[model samples]
Target: MNSGISGYVIQRLLGTIPILIGVGIVTFVLVRVLPGDPAVFYVTGPVVTQEAVQAVREALGLDQPLYLQLFHYFGQILTGDLGRSLTTGQAVTVSLMQRLPASLELSIVAMTLAIALSIPLGIIAATRLGTWSDYAIRFAATVGVSLPASVLGILLILVFYYYVGFAPDPIGRLDPFVATPQSITGFLLIDSLLAGNLEAFRSAAAQVALPALTVALVVMGPILRITRSSMVDVLTSDYIRTCRAAGFNWWTTYVRYGLRNALLPVLTTVGLIIAYLIGANVVVEKLFAWPGVGAYSIDALLASDYAPVQGYMLLMTALFVVINTMVDVLSALVDPRVRAQ
Candidate 1:
C-alpha cells in the first residue's frame, strides 16, 4: 500500500512537467502578442529618439526572432532564471519573491479563516437540517457566493474604514507609523511577532483584516456548501446508521464517524479554494493597494512587460499544479481506498 502511494505521488509529480511546459509556451506567446512596445514603456519622455528605443529593445533581447527568443526563454527557465523585468530592470524572480510573501500571508490567513468557520457551520447546518440555523447558514452561503469579490471588498472598506472608522487604512501590509520588524519571514504579522513587537503585530493585523476578511467571505461559500453536502451524505451513510444502532449517541456518532468521512470532500474543496485565493486575488490586492504578485502582474500587463507577465503566469501555473498535486496526495492519504484503487 505504501509503495502504491509512493508510485502515485511520483506519477502525479512527473505529470506536471508537461503542464508547466505548455503553460510556459502559452504564456510566452500571449505576452508577446500584447499590443505595446516595452521599450516605449520603459523610456520616459514626451519625445524619444529612435536610437534610444532601438538600444532598449536590443538590451531587452526584443530584436531576436520569435523562435530564438522562445528557445532562449526555455533555456533560461531550465536554469532557474526568469529574466529581468523590462520596466523595472529588476530580476523577475527577485521582484516576485519580494511580493509573494504578502500574497501568501493574506491567502493563508483567509483560507484558514474560511476553513475554520466553514466546517463547524457546515456541520451545524447538516445536523440541524430544516431548522432556522440551517436556513440561516444556507442563506448566508448563497449571499456569499453571489457577491462579487471587488464589490465586497469595496463595501467592507467603506463600512469599516469610512463609516465605522475602525478598520485600519485599507492600504499596504503595515502602517507607516509602525516600525517594520526585521524581515525574518517577510510576513509583517509573523515578523513583528518574532521581533516581540506587539504594537507592530496589531498594526499589521489591522491592516490585513479587511482584505483578508473580504477574501475569506468570498471563498467560504463553496467550502461551506461542499462541507454541508458531504456531511449530509455521510450522516445518512450505513456506518453512521450502524454507529447509531450500536448505541452510540448523536454527538459521538456524528463526530467520530460522520465528520471523518465527510472531511474528504471538504478537504478537496478547501484545497481548490486555497489555490483560487492565492492566484485570483488580483481585485482584492489592487483595491487594498496590497503589494502582491497579483497587483504586480496587473502593472506588468499594463506596461506590456513580457518577462514579468510571463513569469507571473508560469509561477502561478506551477503553484496551481503543486497545490493540486498536494491535494491529490492528501486525499489518497485520508482515504486508503483511493490509494488502493
Candidate 2:
C-alpha cells in the first residue's frame, strides 16, 4: 500500500511537467503583450531623451525577439534566476522572498480560521436542514459571499478599532513605534515568540487580525456552501443509511460512514480557495498596507516592471500546480478508485 501511494505521488508529479510548461508559456507571452514599454515606465519624469529610452530598452533586453527572450527566460529559471527588478535593481527572487512570508502568514491564518469555522458550521447546518438555525447559517454565508472585501474591512475596523478599541491600528504588520523582531524566519509572529518577545508578537498579531479576519470571512463562503452540499449528498448514501439502521446515533453514522466520502469535494474546494487566496487578497493587503506579494504584483503591474510581473505570474503558477498536485494525492489516498486509476 505504501509503495502504491509512492508510485501514485510520482506519477501525479510527473504529469504536472507539461501543465507547468503551458503555464510558463502563457505567463511569458501575456505579460510582455501589455501596452507600454518597461523603459518608458522606468523614466521618473515625463521628459526623457529618445537615446536614453533606447539605451534602457537595450539594457533590459527589450529589443530582442519575443521567442528568444522567452527562451532566455526559461533558461534563467532553470538556473534559479528570476532576473532583477527594473525599478529597485533587486533580484526578483529576493523581492518575492522578502514579501512572501507576510503573505504566507496571512493566507495561513485566514485559511485556518475559515476552515475551522466553515466545516463544523456546514455540518451542523446540514444536520439541521430546514430549521431557522440552518437558515441563519445560509443567510450568513450569502451575506459573506456578497459583501465586497473593502466594505467588510471598513466595517470590521470601525467595530473593532473605533467602537471596541481593542484591535490595533490598521497600519502595517508592526507599528513603526514598536521595535521589529529579529528574523530567523521571516514570520514576525513566530520569530518574536521564539526570541522571547511576547510584546512584539502581540502587537503584530493585533495589527494583522482584522485584515486576516476579513479575508477569512470571504474565503469561508465557498467552503461552507460546498461542505454543506457534500454533507447533504453523503447523508443520503446507502452506507450511511445502513449504519444508521444498525442502532447507531446520527453523529456516529455520519462520522463513520458519511464524512470520509464527503471530504473529497470539501478538500478540492479548500485547495482551490488556498490558491485563489494566495493572489486574490490584493485588496485586503492594500487596505491594511501589508507588504505582501499581492501588493507587490500590483506595484509591478502599475509600473510596467516586466521582470517582476512575469516572475510573480510564474511563481503563482508554480504554487497552484504544487497545491493542486498535493490535493490530487490526498484525494487518491482517500478514494481507492482514484489509486486504481
lDDT of each: 0.89, 0.87
Count of steric clashes across candidates, in order = 0, 0
Please provide, for model 1 over 14-118, each residue's C-alpha lDDT reduced to its tens digit, 9 standing for 90 to 100.
888999899988898888887878888667678898988998889878899988999999999999999888678799999999999999999999988888888
* Estimated TM-score for each candidate: 0.95, 0.91
Top-TM-score candidate index: 1
- List residue ranges in candidate 1 displaced over 4 A: 44-46, 245-250
Lowest lDDT sum, 10 consecutive residues, model 1, at 1-10
lDDT of 1: 0.89
Compose the digit string of candidate 2's lDDT tens values, residues 1-341: 47877777688678777876787788788888889877986655667988888888898898899999989998998898998887788999999999989888899899999999998899888888999999999999999999999999999989999999988888889978888989979998999998998889989888888999999998899999998999999888888778867889866877656778888989999999898888888999999999999999899888888778878877787787778878878888898877778
- Shift in Å, residue 293, candidate 1: 0.9
Q: What TM value does model 2 have?
A: 0.91
Q: What lDDT, from 0 to 1, does candidate 2 have?
A: 0.87
Candidate 2, after superposition: displacement of residue 34 in Å? Answer: 1.9
lDDT of 1 at 129: 100
